[model samples]
Target chain A: MTGDGQSQARPRFEFRRNTWILAAGFLALLCAVNYFLQDNFFEPGVMVSNLTTFTPLILIAIGQTYVILASDIDLSVGAIVSLVNVVTVSIMHHLGGDALAVAAGIGAGVATGLAAGAANGLCVAALRFQPIITTFATGTVFAGLALWILPDAGTVQAPEPVWRTYSASFVGVPFVIWSLGVVALGCWLYSRSRPYLTLMAVGGNIRAAFGSGLPVMRTRIAGYVICGLFCSLGALALTGETATGDPLIGIAFTLSSISAVVLGGTALSGGVGGVLGSVLGAILLGLISNVIFFAGTPFEYQNLIQGVIVLVALAGGVFVSRGGAR
Target chain B: MSAARERTRSGPRWYRHSLVLTLAIIVVLFAAGETLSPGFAAPGQVIYLLVTASLLGFVAAGQNLVILGGREGIDLSVGGMISLGALIAGNVMDASNAAILPALLATLAGTFALGAVNGLGVTFLRIPPLVMTLGMYGVIQGLLIVITRGVPSGRAAPMLSAFVNEPLVLGIPGILFAWAAFAAFVIWMLRSTAFGLRIYAIGANENAAALSGVAIRRTRVLLFALSGMCAGLTGFLVLGFSGNVFIGVGDQYMLPSIIAVVIGGTSLAGGIGGHHGTVAGAIVLVLLQSILTTLNIDPSGRAMIFGGTLLLLMFFYGRQQRLRV
Candidate 1:
């Protein structure tokens, strides 16, 4: 985030200032290619299905954007998701799967996630443990706890109605879309709040923000807290989609969320980006895989192609972000 | 002249004692495990633990260098490299004893090249080392899938397995001997070589190191490549230890490698840790695993205890050095 591109006022220059635009441009191009390749890409049903599948990533990226905005990284999101998912499902199993049981299970999951985030915040911002290792340690702990709680996978699931609700639509709009709308709206509202600006200032220059009397510590904690909450929410969506509890479920999402965050135009060093681009970034990542799938790539080679493209997207952001470095 | 070498080899007295402290903890923990389980202190069990330790030692050695090189240095692709190395070793040797040397050279050189690409992306392309290696990790996974055509197959030559498991002398496994030689070479390189000082300088202050004419970019790339080679060695070791290959075999080594380095008291911020401590660190981790298993604590509980211990260890080591004004 340090010594990045200079701020420019013109529309053309503004395009360079916003690296998310790169993600957007790529997403559009991919969508176009995908649309031509897949006959049903634009169909309402397929669109709804794709949105539901990708919503969790978008949500996690949004959360990650907050932490990265404050120049901190959370490696524990995937572990938190696993913990929250298992905790939710196990609680539902204990409570006999009633509606009230579902509500309590979700509440417990979210609360547990928030607590984990606060602990990460305390370690990094207060105790001054290095963010990467601290989170790695905590992630191991959280994943361990998840394995303890649900030693066996697929033995517990939220009731059928939960998945039903996730699969169902309201007024011709999918539940996932509505949830995404609320999330996007919430992010927009938070962007206008004092804490959001405080986080931005802290990320842009920590000593300067501290010198300016900003409550840097609290804002940093809040960033991690928000990240934890969103991760838990993403877990909830995952639970609904998979409808089962598995300790190993989140192993892949940890890095994928980081990829989505970086791909969205947010600087890895933090500051100078928004959740909007992250949302697009997450969608862009989803689309890349989608495009690859539609392009008739074999299942074996899909991962290789995805990895190459993700690297390209990262390199794409470099020309703009590294301008000042050169 | 001997005193000067000693000072360079061990650094200040305080740094030397951290190794002693870690060894002391190892002894205390071993004693505790023996008290809990009668056979825990037996040469057989201890040797097995050490055999396990050496496999991880190879990885931590590489991790030790990259972390020492600084700039948020971490090799997320070690797991991938290990898997790739294992697969390549398996395919080239194709169960033949005669091809072992070629397999060894090929695995090291191949993984080092891929690791160099990790370096090129990180330095020349200005990609963050963390993400660059991460993407490479996925790429390696994809490569694994493509090469095996979905099912992993191959066998270690009989001698290779014997080298890993059978005692070479004094009831010591050949792998341990291999580990001792590797550790000595790495320690020598770190203490005696000009590149060692350059690594410390760059980790401490990149701009100042650059201003002082240190080849920061080249050194970092070389360091990453070395880390890759280390992971490649781990893969080779794993193939011998297990007698075959498994999909994603190296994935489990990822966290333990870093944990070994950090627990060895190597600073995560870089420049302040060494491979000597990491040997004890690897032993400490294997001991933890063995002790936890003997206590009848399940894997989850073992993980929790390991993580909890790691957090406590962080309380002692790797915090950003606070300057006293």
Candidate 2:
């Protein structure tokens, strides 16, 4: 198989696999922080609650990983999430919150995400615009459309208790956590298998990948579509927590998701890192904020600390690679 | 004597003239506005136009410099730095003391420091410019919000305000002098300095620059720091012009700076632009906005037009580059 010689040549995958071992120590530090601060520290219920709170962000980060891994970016994901949430809530209200409306809302969210992703793909692949600029412009347009659709923020008219329970937890674990399993399985299969390998090859060296007869454009477009799907899922999860339609709700989702992706050791250069790493990175960030909350640090301090973490983590990656310590 | 040696030294000339075409487009757009609304042609209105474009002009200059230096270097934190700098300056300066120099220094220093962090991240950390600056943008925005607590405080001294708002000789706005001085400084720096040569070399080809023993990391850091300093200075100017700093001021500048840089015919991929083009680009953008406002176009229609124009410009720029070969 072409994979054998290729796999041996790549130090990145090995680095990625072994990196999780070090995460245990970081996770332990987080546990220690939580224990010292919060009363419910290490409790099963609290852990589950933390998972629930982080669900939407992790979901969005999963999709963001796909795009980032493909050596592209999607700034409109947050805007897409906002658009999806607003649209879903508005549609449910107008359609009387029936099962069909709920289904339609979910479908609409997917469609919106796909359309936005496709636009990004077209800009990147066909128009050859930079991912940053194209996505930035599309983000504004999508957010504007969201505002036009839902001019005001309001609570959705759905039966709250059912959704609250369904969204919050199932069988003592967050429903989002279970959903995480599904996403993890999918991510694992994609990343460890042929299509993902091809994607990584494409991202790592587009010219080489193209010359090797890999469908570069198709793979990239597919990556974006997958990202869009995950973003929709993120939006759906967010609906349960918010219970209201906020056209601007996902304001920092893009930055936070990217932060999570980077912290998870995903190379922004693409073709490195996996969805699981991103998920853990999201959890790390979520816990950092959680620690801040429990420690009574101001929200501003949380942001400052997060910024520091981003800087340190990014710096850490470079130093490791340079020192050959990875 | 080889074509490769010569061709590699300079990019195609016509593509660099995007600023001229951009300016011409704006003039044509303004002429259309004059036909539509005669007030747009008045001296006072034109001065107002110059004043409005000056801040963005400075931002475009900073942006173009970084992009020209290479490594996909664009400052996403320009807006955040502007807002944060203004807030820091306003909060620290005792308006009662009117210690203008110190106040401005403190603000500028803080902004420079914020920008320095961005530089350090991009250069030393090996983070991609897009992500590094983006992270800084988030950090700065968050810090600004926290410091201001969602409401900006303090006001600029009357002297500064008058200087910014009042027109200078020949009915020219004082902002024009400021812009001219800045543009001249940038032009001189790019043409004469070793640093400028490194920026050109790095932008042209990073590998080549490295092979030539250029300090790629240091140049990138300096470029990012300089961009931040320019952004900070513009923040102070913004305060003088607007009389107060507001939360939205920084975010508003982001897209305009980028749009100005690209429309000025500065390649997003870097290594081929100057302050002259950026200034022209900024003027064009300001002119477009003024004409749209005068025509009483709805905001959405205006956005569509702006976005459509940007796409069209990109297309034309792309086509011209392809044609050159």
Give one digit per residue, the lDDT tens place, for model 1 in B71-135: 88889999999988888888788778898999999999999999999888877777888888888
Chain A TM-score of each model, in the order shown? 0.94, 0.89
In the range A55-160, model 1's lDDT, one tens digit per residue, is 8888888888898889899988888889999999899879988899899989998998899899989888877787888888898899899999999899887888
Encode model 2's per-residue lDDT on B42-149: one tens digit a residue. 888888888889988877777887888777778888998888767766665645347668778987788777777788877655566776887788677668767777
iRMSD for every model: 2.9, 6.8
List model 2 lDDT by residue over A1-326, tens digit each.
Answer: 11211132444555654433333346578879888999787788787778878899999999998898888888888888988888878877777777877778778878888887887677666677767666777776677677767766775544464266456656766776787788778887777788898888877777778888888888888888888888888888888777778878886898788877776666676776667667777888788777778888776567766666665654544332222242
Indicate the DockQ of the complex predicted as candidate 2.
0.31
- DockQ score for candidate 1: 0.47
User: For each candidate, what's the DockQ?
Assistant: 0.47, 0.31
Give per-residue lDDT, candidate 1, residue B39: 88
CA-only RMSD, every prediction: 3.1, 4.4
Worst 10 residues of 1 chain A by lDDT: A1-10
Q: Which regions of candidate 1 are displaced past 4 Å?
A: A1-17, A323-325, B1-17, B322-325
